[model samples]
Target chain A: MKIEHPYLMFLGDAPDELAAKTAIGIKQWRPEWCVAQLSLPGCQADLGLPEMSIAEAKAAGVKTIVLGVANRGGIIGPAWMETLLAAIDAGMDIANGLHTRLSTIPELVQAANAKGVKLFDVRHFDGKLPVGNGEKRPGKRVLAVGTDCSVGKMYTALALDAEMKKRGMKSTFRATGQTGIFIAGEGISVDAVISDFISGAVETIAPANEPDHWDVVEGQGSLFHASFAGVSMGLIHGSQPDAIIVCHEPTRTHMRGLPGYKLPDLKTTMDVNLMHARLTNPDCVVAGFAINTKSLDDAAAKKLLAEVEAEFGLPCVDPVRTGVASIVDKLQEI
Target chain B: MKIEHPYLMFLGDAPDELAAKTAIGIKQWRPEWCVAQLSLPGCQADLGLPEMSIAEAKAAGVKTIVLGVANRGGIIGPAWMETLLAAIDAGMDIANGLHTRLSTIPELVQAANAKGVKLFDVRHFDGKLPVGNGEKRPGKRVLAVGTDCSVGKMYTALALDAEMKKRGMKSTFRATGQTGIFIAGEGISVDAVISDFISGAVETIAPANEPDHWDVVEGQGSLFHASFAGVSMGLIHGSQPDAIIVCHEPTRTHMRGLPGYKLPDLKTTMDVNLMHARLTNPDCVVAGFAINTKSLDDAAAKKLLAEVEAEFGLPCVDPVRTGVASIVDKLQEI
Candidate 1:
């Protein structure tokens, strides 16, 4: 059955627009699925969408509650339990993509059971994958990598893929995260994969060889994010893309959740990503930028894009506010 | 209970001395634990030790069988299952570190259960780990990294640690692989860690805070191996070592399981490792090389080591034959 409606749940405030990546992605990719967003009064980030209460969501026939924001710990905080329990009592299933599973919480489990509501932990998918043989896969493809974690890599890739499909192109959006898995209906939650199979997981999901085909593989973690940079390198090598779109949120000053560790500049991130990606495909190139200008106004974003494009010699666009036409056109041109 | 006695089992042929890593490590690290080795006549790679058959092994009163020598696919092949079943029937417990578990094999499981023998699968340990914050951990330490999979990385670290201890310095051997887990009684099994926590897993075990301590972090996978480079990168950053010992097998032409990919030379491997390690610790340096000259004769080995030392301007030694004294001494001098 088609997911005609969904209720996104963000129980607290995000530090910035970048941290609101989940809601931003849904609003851009599948706006119709979001029937309502549950946020407390005087709290929440703007994704250019309206908000709705739990009762309003039930009245509107919302089927699932999407935990749409990633917290620092990726666990359901105590402050939000009351709201989550109410959602379960309203007979709605909860779909979470955090590291901590809702099933592990006995109170949530009991409440969900009493109401006959199911719980879906989207990040629990794991399986061994064969070693990636680093050969150049046939056809034109690109991946969207980022300067930091949750910086709009998936949204950029999906937007570019959606645009290509609209023009009747043979394009595929390959997901590597739980949110992407939920959206694509099927994909490996790559973080759950064994270390030896991390690259192989990407290679399998985003395999190329079809004539005139393109695969926009999703990137996970960040090359500079000390906690999980291993996954970043795996995806970079596994995708073996002919081109790459570097994604970033302009206003973030430091690495997410990791204090004292500063974010590398755009140039450093691109250079590092290309060096690692070329560890597999020597022909890989930085094609463009999927700039998340959510933190900046239209005027500031335009100014920043001009400077970045001039310095990096690549086309830059916001997948949400500005369409990803430049990036799509650039990849096709290559 | 201490593992005072173990029966080493290498069911089939190993490609080279480098492939007999488990036996080499055991002979050096815990010789008392190895009661005997099980190998067919006219077979078995040289570990500078004698081989024993199953009948002789039983006559010697062996208690537990240690799965030595990693195979091509990490699965118990058809030819080996019969021998493994026979060992179980003879009232000996089994301990396996292969990717495929003995519990999954119905025939072996039933036989072990009937004979009241226990099975230990060492690669199944996994859990969620916090991300590495990339903070400056206290004290000085070094990690042993390699250019390819199973190229004597773990053995190098253990040898270095042992030598350091013999010199009366404070040092610890931290294992990151299944073989090391078996030897150390406990470890994170770095390959089994979730992608998001790869670095964190390394940090948790190899943490350093003492003013005069060192952590000899065992390496896994390789920087150039496309299959699991992510894990390598994560371990590099998570451990945040002051120095790194690069391990390599002169005979490994391609990656262990991934063919068509030529091995990166020492300089290239060191350059790549330093580039990634510098992402976390800019002060990190490539200390030396733990060369695996298992295929060469004694005279040929000395010549190759001298040439390698002259070229890279770093101390070079085989952990098993040369005993890692040069690497340990060089680290102390640093």
Candidate 2:
């Protein structure tokens, strides 16, 4: 059966305050989206109110349900599995977006498969706004800000924005993953303000704690965020963007040089998460970018871009070229 | 400081009754090995007792210790981790073998790394065995059997045995793992017969219940029996065998298609077990075989082997090739 008015959910371990804030953030993204904020219980007996949410979803004709399957503060086991099964049996489509744990996947998959339920792996959706017509112009611009974030990612995002804008395309700056949260009071206010200011040419400040939150933001833009967590998978799964940009660490510079660096561990995680996502939602575009130039040396920048393109099979541009002219050029072509 | 004559200990979740028998099995292979078997609680309490024993080694020393890592009929968790750390700190070397729960690898790796101790990821080591050495006329034919009570793993052991015998090489099989307990016997008469038969081939029959009962029967192989409840990692660390072979049901056949079949969930319990094996012994081989080959065909099999080789940069062969003459040709060259 096709699900109608489906609500995407993310299950994970966050502080109680963070959980409440995340719930608020999710609500802001989709005002009409039915969200159940369940506080992870320390024991089976403590699983008091969440049980009712499962029952309510079934009774209220909710077809789709997303769950963050991580227990950050406590241990979840067979009893938790039983609770999840009840939700599925009650006809809630189950999806998982997790980073810290991997064992949970098999059990969740086995449960979903057993009940003939759809399991969406929300790691393949890339959050990119489509470019319409043959015109290239400056699109909307967004500046994502975070403290102690990866500088390479910021540059790549800006470059993409400039390229799109040069074609007369409009784009927005998305503050996603840790950076998004950092700007939104997860850290010092001074640091956040400074970051926001440095992120020049930002049109709209779309701050997102998780990648899936990008779905709600309107406009064509780039996501510039530090992603040590499973942010890449979440953004890819939730957004289904035209392209993706990743900032590579300096020590591990060459994309394909290291054994596990080129694709990174994220690729394996994506393979599993996206396979599930594709099974549920088939239309998705996959692309990637890597930031390499530390200085404005044009040759070095181009080399880095070329390497990124070769490794991820995506179009990459030098970060130095990210300016109004580049944006206009991109907009004219788009 | 580098440890001399270091003890490599393995702790697992074998039933209390089968601990001694498992210890015996281990001792047989390393006659100069010292063997010690201890109950899960006793081991955890740091009761200053040797876990298992083998004959005295003139060169280094023969000391084998096995302890139960999990409680009787209980799921593994943080307590298990604490217990394991204490044991390792108390001078135990490795924990579970390759078949261990995937939830424990990070902790095990951390503990080993912290103490400068060695870890064995059993599954990978056992799975990747070199079928034929590069010498002409092939190397010695060896059949390793893990006899515990888990029927799920019988097919894997049998397949390895069959493959080894098929190569026109003389091979002998012994009971290891859960099946070893049956040979040691608690209530079953089949244990005696199985024990007697295996005694001829195996140097030590690891009785699950008695760790110190190293009974030396004339002409009968040594019996080293001990519990391996969560000690799959231990097997991977210590025994850098030619290859590793595992038996599982059709449900597990999907593992064959994984990036690294032996280390599919390396971050998890299963992968941790396999990783320990791979890391402890870099030159060892790792492979896996399921009893249900119905899901496997020529194309699927070749793809599976290719996946293993690509992930680990190692050679993998099908157990079905035990009868193929080309196997002999490859072995002869090895």
Q: TM-scores of the models, in the given order? A: 0.79, 0.29
- In model 1, what lDDT does residue B56 have? 73
Candidate 1 residue runs with Cα over 4 Å from true position: A1-24, A33-120, A297-299, B1-24, B35-95, B100-120, B297-300, B320-323
Residue pairs clashing in model 1 are none
Listed models, DockQ each: 0.65, 0.01
CA lDDT scores, all candidates in order: 0.79, 0.34
Docking class of 1: medium
Alpha-carbon shift of residue A233 in model 1 (angstroms): 0.7
lDDT, candidate 1, A1-334, per-residue tens = 1122465555355556666676666666777777777765445567665577777788888888877677777767766787788888888888776768888999999999889887777787544578777777776668888889988898888888899999899988887887786576457878887777888888888876686898889888888888878988899989987888899987787889887777788898898888877877788899888888888888998898888889988888888888889878788777
Model 2, B1-334: lDDT tens digits are 0112233334444444344333433333333333343334433332233653222221234221233233454445564566556655554454232235433567767766777765432221221111111111112221221212232333334444444556654433333333232222111111212111211112222112232111211111100111111122112222323344332233342222222122123113223233323332333333433223345776776676566446644343444432223323333332
Instruction: Write one digit per residue (lDDT tens) for candidate 2, span A1-334.
Output: 1223334343433444443343334344333554343333542211112333567656655566644333455454564566567767776675433322323458766767778777543321222222111111122222221111343544445445535544554454343332222112111111111111111111123322343222111111111111111122122223323233333443343232113222233344224333322321343223343444555477766676666557655554444453334323332332
Q: TM-score, chain B only, every model?
A: 0.74, 0.31
The parts of candidate 2 lying over 4 Å away from their true place are A1-151, A157-212, A215-243, A246-284, A287-316, A323-334, B1-36, B39-64, B72-334
**Worst lDDT 10-window in candidate 1 chain A:** A1-10
CAPRI quality band, candidate 2: incorrect
